[model samples]
Target: MQVTLKNFTKTFDDTTVIDSMNLAVNDGEMLALLGPSGCGKSTTLFAICGIHRINGGQILFGDRDVSDVPSQKRNVGVVFQNYALYPHLTVFENIAFPLSVRGDSKPDIEREVRAIAALTHIEELLARRPAQLSGGQQQRVALARALVRKPDVLLLDEPLANLDAKLRLEMRSEIRRIQLETGITAILVTHDQVEAMSMCDRIAIMNKGEILQIATPTDMYRAPVNKFVAGFLGNPPIVMLEGRTSGDGRFLVKEGTSLPLPARLAGMPGDTPLSLGVRPEHFGAAGANRVEGTISFVEPQGRETLFDVTLDDGVVLRSIQPARDDVVFGQKVVWPLDAEKLLAFDVSGRAV
Candidate 1:
């Protein structure tokens, strides 16, 4: 189903949680609503699922406005963060609850529940109670229950947050596989950037009750529309250096270090203050246009090593490189800057 939110607004008393937001989830697309906590991502999901009423605007499911539809009438399934499984219910009963509540026949409910249980790979645990199941198994049961109804849209609100790191990774792959296999439109709410990037077809970044940017993961990372989007999407985060353009194809950073500007930015007026963002991976071994610094800290992270390098002016920068055993503290190191990979933002935090 194609889900559309046009100028959707939700407010609590005098405070607004969603402000005239507009978005669309393509038919059969798995789009992630990604942002920090209290960013109104969950509120938006609730609005779509009819759990929260919108104070303004319209919501459409394939051209039919469902803004006034009741939660149970929307044909949407939600898998919440806590799983919400009943402690006394067996896996089979829990997965069959939705069908049973709707008055489906016994044979129909049994067939549907068993079919979805197999799809979620929880058929073997059908006889177990919620307390007897592991975290991952419980999660599968929740998903199976949600999918058994064959809802047009599936909503997952931080569904993997309770799992361990290994299980989270495994479930990420499982969710993606299920979404594809069933061809159901899915919306995932997550604060984890890695999860959003690795699982969804596209991501809609939200903040302060507003939609920031919506794009495929690659586009959102490679060409962020603004500084906030740039800084929020990366692991280790994007390093932002406050600087000013020299107008002579150079950028003068705060510490008095001048680096050449990209050709596209050559026309910027002289002394135009801006923020330069660079990812840690972009910093490499010394080469032409290298910046010199001394290693302040070295962290070996399996395949890569992270170095905290202090510049001559005492500004510390993080750089990621291949893990090396010979690196020592206080050792001078030089890293080259990739002009193409650098991002420039104006005082307003908009990408230049």
Candidate 2:
């Protein structure tokens, strides 16, 4: 199913939660709404599922208008964050609850529940109650229940948030596999960048009730439209160095630090304030642009280590590289910055 929102607006009392937003989720494609808390990710999901009445705009499921449809009549399935399950009901009974509510026959419900259980790899846990299963197992039961009805659109509300780190990694692949095998249109709402980047086909980055940018993970990472988009997508976050354009075709970092400006950015009006954004991986040992700094902070990340290098003028650049005993904290070292990979933003935070 293809889901679309045109001028999708929502309000709570007087404040608008979703401002005249427009987005199209392709047919059978998984899209994620990623942002910080209270960014309207959940509000948008509920509106699409008919749980919240929008203050304005329209929502369509393919060619049908579902804006006025009731929650139960939309034929959409939602797997919530907490994996809402009945403690008293057995796994089989929980999976069959939705079917039972619709008054389906005993045989029909049995076949559907068993088939979904097998798909979710939970057939063995059918006789057990929610309290008897692990977090991952309970999650599978929730997914099974949602899929048993063969819903047109499957909504996942941070479905992996309750699990441990290992389980979250395990279920990421599991959910992706099940979604592909079933070919159902899925919308995932998450604040975790790793979850959104790894699990979905495309991500719509939301902030303060507006869609900032929507693109594939690679595209968004390579070229963000603004400072916020560039800074929001990466882990450890993209480092933004404040600077200004100089007359000698260079960028002057605050207080006596300078870098040669690429020809493309050399003519952007003298003294124009600029921000240079560089991802952690882009700072390395060899490149055309170099800066000398001291390793001030060290964070060991298994095979790779994160180091904060405080350069001349006190500019700090975070670099992630292979584990090395050669570089110790407070030691001076010169690192290179990939000129072509650097991101430039103007005063308004718009990409230059």
Candidate 3:
């Protein structure tokens, strides 16, 4: 099933939350709605599942318009962040509950429940109640329950937020594998970039209740449509410094640093105010564009070290390198910038 929101609008009291948004989820693909808190991601999810009513426009399931359908009538299943489960019910009962509601025969219900239990690798856990099972097991039960109904669409809202680090990683792969095997069109609402990047086929970046951009993770990261999308997508983040094009074809940072302008920006007019951005990983040891800075901070991440490079003008930028002791705190060093990978944004925050 392909879910779509067309010119959808929603409001609360005097404020408009979602404003004339149009989006489509490809059939049998996992799509993620990624953004920071209060960005209307949850609101959009609720509107699709019918928890929140739309103020205008339409919601569609493939070619059929489901705009006026009630929540119960829509053939969609939701797996919530908390993994809503019945505490008193055993795993078998929990996974079987959905089919029971639809009046399936006892033999059919038992067969289906056991089948889903095997698929989720929770056959042994069928006898345990929610409280007796691990978080991962409970999650599987919730997923099995959602899938048992054979919903046209599956909605997951921060489904892995409750797990520990290792379990989260494990479940990310598990959910993605199950999604592929089932071929169900699913929507995931999450703020975690890794979860979105690792799990979804494409990501829809949202902010201020509007769909900013939608594309595969690689494309969105390599070529963000705007400054906000670029900044929001990376870990350790891209270092953005205010700069302007000098008549001599150089990017002059306001903090008294200058570098050769990228070849792609050669035709840009001089004195154009630009926001220069470079990822931490792009700063290296060999490039014509270089900056000398004192190491003010060194953070030892397992396999990589994140160094805070402070320039003479007191501006700080982060650089990532393999963990080594060649440079320490307060040591002066020169790091080259990969000018080709530097991104420039205009005053309006649009990429140049």
Candidate 4:
């Protein structure tokens, strides 16, 4: 179903939680609302689900304005961060409870519950109570319960936050698989950039109750509309530097830093004030543009090493290199920058 929020606004007391926001979720497409804490991601979810009354605007579910509809009547299923399962009930019983509440017959409830259990790969744990299952299993049960209803739109609010690193990775794949197989329009609310980037079809980045940018994960990362979107989406984050354009329309970094601008930017005003940004992975060992710095720290990951280098101006920059490289902290190095990978932003943080 296509869900649309027009002129949406929400307020608590005198503070507005959601400004005049407008967004549309295309039919069958998964949209993730990503941001830092208290950015109103969950509030927007609840507003759509009819849990919170909107201060303004209309909400349409495929041409039907359901803004005034009650939460139970919205046909929306929500999975929360904590996996709010009924500890006293077995997994099968927990999954069956939602159906029972809707007045389904004994046989129908059992059949649907079993079907959902199989889909979530929790069939073997059906007879176990929540306490007896692992965190991932319990979350799966919660997911099964939510999906058993065949909801029009499934809303997940940091559903994997409680799991361990490995389990979170596993569940991300599992959730994406199930969502794809079911073809349900899902909205995921998460603060984790990795989770949003890895699993979401597209992401709506929010801040202080406003939508900053919305795009597919790749586009959002490769071409962020502004500094906030650029900084928010990437792991290790994008590095920024104070820089400016030269008189001949050439971009220049600090004294010891030199990075080419994209060929398309050759004609831009040379005196324009700008900031330089480049993703960690975009840093190279051989390129026409380079930055000289001393390694400040080395973070070793299994497959890559994160290099923190202090540039000439004392600005720390990050570079991701292969684990096989022998670069170490306190070592002087010249890191190359790919001109095409450079991002330029103005004083307001908007990309130029």
Candidate 4: tens digits of C-alpha lDDT, residues 247-331 = 5646666644545676667677776778889788878554677777899988899798898888776778788877945776799
lDDT of each: 0.91, 0.91, 0.91, 0.88
Candidate 4 Cα outliers beyond 4 Å, as residue runs: 252-258
C-alpha RMSD values across all candidates = 1.1, 1.1, 1.1, 1.7
lDDT, residue 37, model 1: 96
The count of residue-pair clashes in candidate 4 stands at 0
After superposing candidate 3, which stretches have Cα over 4 Å from the reference? none
lDDT of 3 at 144: 95
Candidate 2, residues 33-128, lDDT tens digits: the string is: 999989999999999998899889999999999999999999999999998998889999999999999999999999999899999999899999
Against the true structure, candidate 3 has what lDDT? 0.91
Candidate 4 lDDT: 0.88
Q: Count the backbone clashes (under 3 Å) in each candidate.
A: 0, 0, 0, 0
Candidate 1 structure quality by residue, lDDT tens digits, 1-352 = 9999999999999998888999999999999999999999999999999999899999999988999989999999999898999889999999999999999999999999888988999989999999999899989998998899999999999999999999999999999999999999999999999999999999999988888999999999999999989999998888899989988989999888787777789888999999999788877653357888899998889998988888898777778888887878999977786776788999999998
Give the winner by lDDT: 3 or 4.
Answer: 3
TM-score of model number 1:
0.98
Ten-residue stretch with the least lDDT total in model 2: 259-268
